[model samples]
Target: MKSVLQIGKKILLVLMIIAVIIAGTRSIGMGMNIRTPKNGINVSFYVDINGSNQWINIYGKDIDNPVLLYLHGGPGSATSPIDYSFTRKWSDVYTVVTWDQRNVGKSFDKKNAADKITKDIMLADGKAMTEYIMKYMGKKKITLLGHSWGSMFGANLVLEYPQYYDAFIGTGQCVDIAENEERLYEEAKKWTEGDEEGKVLLSKWSPDKCDDTQALLARSEIMNRYGYGMMKDGRDYNIVATILFNPNYLVKDYISYVKNIETSMEPYMDFFAHGLYECSLLGKYDYKVPYYNINGDMDYQTNYEMACEYFEKVNAPDKKMYVMKGGTHGLLESRSEEFSGYVHDIAKRMASMK
Candidate 1:
């Protein structure tokens, strides 16, 4: 009887150990398997920026044709392994370069990042990445497409280094920091009032309680539940989930190309808390660049009005604003036939100028 009991205990211990190993592997395996499109051109990516060696994923065929060096949103959101989303279709027209900025994605080893992140370090990184892309591809000029946080960086990049880009496209353009905060607060208010779960969650979103990461994440989840409603069919969470996580990001790419919110999970969360708040990347507005501002009127994140205000006020040699009707921030749908056409039209105009 004693031997049998001991044997049973030992077996149970083995099972528990096996379970833990599986759980541990799964936890670290999220982005480990993600791959760049096999057929796409892969650049010999390297950059010495902010004391970190950054990696680059150069997609598409035509390096000579105006490359759209896509700066992704997260002060840290990466571009590689997920290049399929933002650079599709444009790939045929332009050699799209997706840069995984320092401290994000597979770019610069995290060990290089110090105790605090600064806008200077971030901007220096962007400048270095841009210089590297131009030198690597041997392209004298390229277009800059900045999405969300990417847009913020795009604005600053062009302001500081207008000589590099032939044109600039700002999607989900965040020109005002206070406005974004208000937009988020309002969204939170609406969700709390209408969404029962949101109300339950936000009730606990007090600063004191949300001081920690876990509490803050719970608050963000509640906000996303309400925010995702901006999608057309409404309950496309599975499709949305796939948009963010699936390995084959062809559809995800299309979705991101059209709609702008399908961000990788970690960057999305970190940027929201630290980058958005700490990065002094907005509110100045007064700038000059060949700028085309695109916004989905239904975009709640940056709010269409704020983008328009920048277009109205900012001094630019060539400035145009296109408001996609019925389009939310992530307005990449075939249904937005006019919107897609407009993009092609703008590209043609720029190409013609080139």
Candidate 2:
């Protein structure tokens, strides 16, 4: 019996050691792999943008391909870590780029960023970043694909600096954040009907909770539970699980990705309270370049009905809106491969024009 016990302990210790090694390998992204094709580019590094060290990831099959920059959602939601899911195949057609916006994700710096996240500063950052990308890649103009909060930024950026862009693409478009929240609150209350326990959770939401991330996330959680969340089909979208397979993200990047959502967005609370209500772009987007929007009808985050209504009023040389059936807020992450094809089709046409 004593001899058998000793052998069991030795086996358990070896298994634990092996497990730790495997996990560490995955954490540093060594378990995953990326093969950059001939003449292709796949690299990530820090770049100077607007007096700050902003991080960018660039990948494509051919450097000569048209530049396509993807701006993530969230005033603080950085998507660069998990961007490989949709962008792995994009290099064949586009020189895809993803930037961790200033004071967000890998670009976050507590010492330099003290309440500097504002409309004016972000626009300046966008302009400088656009110039940097154009110069670095030797391109005259590039295309923009903005999602959610990014759509708002992209709209303002192109409208202000039309010379730097060849075309614009928007998904999970942010037309009116104030209107979106109100619509969500009302519908959320309706979902609590005839159910006392549900009402308990619904009571946590109010107009006052708009600037509170924990409260807002709680309300959003309720919305997601009732099928109006990230994905329309009620499939759980787990970024934590998804990140394990992506080679682009180091463990530190993953930590930054999660922590920075709250840290980077803190400065925006005041803007949300004071400036968001009157900030609807219903009729303001008379873009100088061709524009396209890919939206999901089931998206309550941006309010699908309002987006379509606003889309009807947009003016540009070329504009089209493709509404996804039974889609949710994150069409890019949820239906990555299928909908990314939609993006490729749009990008290819724009490249041909250039």
Candidate 3:
């Protein structure tokens, strides 16, 4: 019996070793397959902003294609690494540029640098970055695409400097954030109506009492738990798979991605709670350039109803609203091909106007 037990233990250890090797090999293999556009423009470099370095990745099937500067969500989150899975296809028709905003993702620095990370500072950085890209590509203007928190930033930028952009595209657009939060809070309560555990968890805070960032975060946590914020189907996109396999991001970048969230959350939370509410541009609907609001029908995070209402009221040179059939906050990732196609068509229309 002792001999048999020893043999079984040896077999189990060998299997464990094999599993580790397989996982390692798969990770390396995926990294090796990281792809860039073939016969297209692909540029990855650091740009100086306020004496600090921030990363930008530009990819396109042809350098002559319309420039699309994508501002990712998560005031702290960087979407460049994961963008490879979906936005890469847009390179065929648009020069897709993904930037790591100040003090986030590849741009995060321990020193905190020349300027504090604030809405105005970020807007200035964005404007500077847009000018740089325009000069580099020899284009007078580029299209601006913003997602989630990015929408807020992009809205302000386009409104402030409409001459620099041909069009403004917003997905998961934020409109009157405080109002959206209230709606989200009510939605969360409604979802947890009969569930004892959900009720207990949600009972900790109310929207009326959620004045600070921590309380807002607590409310968001509960909402997300019931598929109100992120995954409506109770299954999150294996974002880990994208992060782990993305070749553009090294092991250090992955670590920074997480650390930056914590770093950015403190300063950015107030903006979400009060600043956005006080200074929201939802009512300022007149825009100089073409405006497009592309959103998921099921997106509760930003409140689809609010986006539509804003879209209807917003007057621009040209404007349109598209509701992604059954998408959620992750509409871009969930419906990449369709969304890209829509943008491509919009680009063509914008070119005709030019």
Candidate 4:
């Protein structure tokens, strides 16, 4: 007996209520809070290190576990977005920390001036972060893990402050930049064979021409074209998705990272434009503490062969080169479980050291 207008009004009200409920639920999800494990530690924080504002995430199943400071690759690439997939399992034995170094990813600020972030600045920031973690965790030394550019940074770090760590491991390790580009050029040509367009691209690139940023980017295109770039299993788009959808990353974090990721390395452009002085760890193989390198067989980015060669020259109290078969530069994420298996062995013993 109700009029059509009356019923329609009621339906509209119900629909509006349902829409609000849905929107509220999603907004809450966007800001999901960290749930720490019982008796363990899980925190995401921001700290100023040597004038650079940075972000850090730490997690563990047991607070007493050995601290493991994971230095992500890229003078600009921040891997904390996909870090949980590979580093979570080790939490049982190691308190893992992932950080976004200065002017990159979660640490990037549009208002900040990063043009002065030189090698000395970066190293100073690294030491400050290490000290911060050690002091906060009430530990004397922490295990160090560096990937790609992190391997470059961390390799120099532990060498300079060998007494501060129990062990240091470099995955997707990068050695000499000049030689790295030389070998990458040859391999890129081998894969791009018979493609005229690819040929034209490679002709403009060479080891010595690395200072030209365009050529360097083209090298990435060539590597990505043949599944020899980030990973043999996936492309860069997939990794970007991981970063955007990461539960630990807020909407603001994702926006900042996407906006500045490509330009993140500009701070070190001047120094890197000349030579490998700050970028290469080749020939400097003396380690006061244990040192290790892990590489994927298909990692053309850092060139696995070069990692093996450098591993051979490294002399340390303990050292090993772990090969992840058929893996790529991104083997850490692609082969997370397998990579964790090896790291577990290392973490367990390292955690118990007197």
Candidate 5:
């Protein structure tokens, strides 16, 4: 009996060891399977911007493919962590680059005061980063893709330096900020006409009356809760889970992702609240490069109508607007394949133009 008990204990110990090994493999395995193709290029590094370090990841199956620099949304939000989900496929065709804009994500600086960061500074950083990427890849020009707040930044960059880009793609494009906000506010009110909680939350802030960023933040929270933002058909996607499981992010990077949002929100809120309205290029109608606006028909965040309006008015050497049916602000995630195909088609057209 004593020998049998000892044998059982040993077996239990072996099982525990096996379990540990499996768990360890799974945790690290998240990124292990990710590999660049032979002759492909994959690089993750930091670039200096105004004496600060900004993080960027560039990956592609072929180094010779056209470069596609993606500008993530969120004046304070970073998309680098989730790039693997969708952008990886894009990398197969184009050298896809994702950057954590200053004051956000891995690039967040606790020592950098909020007052020092502004819209112009961020734009300058983007331009500098583009120049660096061009030089690093031995490419004179690259394609620019921006989403949400990124669209706003990319629009400015393409307008100012059309010579540096082969094409411009704006997803969830922001045309007029004040008008979009007003439309959002009205839509929120309309959607909540039958719901008491939503109305109460929305009533605390009026789009025209409330210029406070906190109020806008509150309004957005309420709207998102009602599935007016990214959620569609009562289906909820866990973005936090997506970020946590990102293989490229370490424990410290994850912590910074959360902390940076809080640290940068106040400064960024003011900029987003006012800058989009005051400096919006709603009336500007001409661009120097091939421009494409791919938008979700159901997107209320940036107002799809405004994007269509801007696309109609804007004149480019080559221009097109593709609307995804029943799509929302999360169109890139929901319809990544379709979006990628559009991008490839546009790239082909761009190559032919050259």
Candidate 6:
């Protein structure tokens, strides 16, 4: 009887150990691993602005060619890893500068407050960072490529300081405030009503009282899944999301860094989310920059049609619209080959005049 009891305890301990190992492995695997581009030089720096320091990345082949300072979406999104995947291809031709805006990623911020992380603060930090990058690289001008929320900031930068950028390219651009919210609401509604699964899933979305918090949780169901259908071929989002969530080489490092960031300063993440959720109302400004708007055929996040309409009215001498056949904003990394090709063409065309 004593021997049997001992044997049972040993088996239980072994099972418990196995369960812990499995759980630990899964927890480590959950973070996204975004890859940096190849052959390009990765540059990092801290820019001091109003007693605060911000971090920026520059993906350039060499100091001789033109450079595009790439502004990432998510006022707080870190573009260092994913921007490298596609921009490195353009490095042979032009330099690409990617940065984590104030209170984001590697930028310094002991406390994250939404009020302090306003668009004005971001633009100010971006301008300071841009000036620092230009001075550091010994370059006069750079092309500006802003994705989603980045476009919002880029727009303000160009309008306020048009002479700073040589040319501008906006991906997943957000132009009108009211229209975008309506589009998102409608998309969610359609997704919820279209399928029984979607209906059951989004049953929590009370259109009348759904705030940003409610919308955030429900976003995965409507945007993540329905995004698959809106893609040019229905599989683009899947491929991109997969890569963002589970990258081969860059995933582990990126996640480790992200975990450090989150653990060290959780308020930063909260501030970022708050800014993204509430900053849509700041989109009523007029633009005065020469720009190109790039849209994926299947992107429903901000509605391609609305973007097209705004581009048509944009007041710039050198502006056009470029569409990816079956791409989404997330494709910037997942579809690196195609994305690199697009950047190459744009760089070549811009370089021709120089």
lDDT of each: 0.63, 0.79, 0.78, 0.79, 0.80, 0.63
Clashes of 2: 1
Indicate the residue-level lDDT of 156 in model 5: 87
Which candidate tops lDDT?
5
Candidate 3: give the clashing pairs.
Answer: none
The superposed Cα distance between candidate 6 and the true structure at residue 180, in angstroms, equals 1.1
Give the per-residue lDDT digits (tens) of candidate 2, residues 183-293. 778887888898786787777777567777667767877877788788655323456555775666666777767766676767667666655544467668588998898
- lDDT (10s digit) by residue, model 1, range 269-311: 5445555555444555545557887788767666677788677
Model 4: lDDT to the true structure: 0.79
Can you write out model 3's per-residue Cα lDDT over 1-354, one digit (the tens) per residue?
999999999999999999898679657856554545566677688998766688888888887788999998876677776786677767777988989888777877667723345667777899899999999999999999999988988998999999899899999988877787778778887888888888877777676654465565677678677665665543233576766677677767777777666765555554554555644776799899999988988788888888998898998999888778777787777667778888877887887887
Can you give the TM-score per candidate against the true fold? 0.70, 0.88, 0.85, 0.85, 0.87, 0.73
Angstrom error of the Cα, residue 144, model 2: value is: 0.6
Model 6 weakest 10-residue run by lDDT: 228-237
Question: Candidate 4, clashing residue pairs?
Answer: none
Count of backbone collisions within predicted model 5: 0
Q: On lDDT, who's better, 1 or 4?
A: 4
Over the stretch 163-184, how does candidate 4's per-residue lDDT look in tens digits?
7888998999988777887788
Candidate 6 or 2, higher TM-score: 2
lDDT of 5 at 224: 78
- Each model's RMSD to truth, in Å? 8.3, 3.1, 3.6, 4.6, 4.2, 6.5
**Which candidate model has the greater TM-score, 1 or 6?**
6
Ranking of models by TM-score = 2, 5, 4, 3, 6, 1
Error in Å for residue 240 of model 6: 14
Point out the higher-scoring one by TM-score: 2 or 5: 2
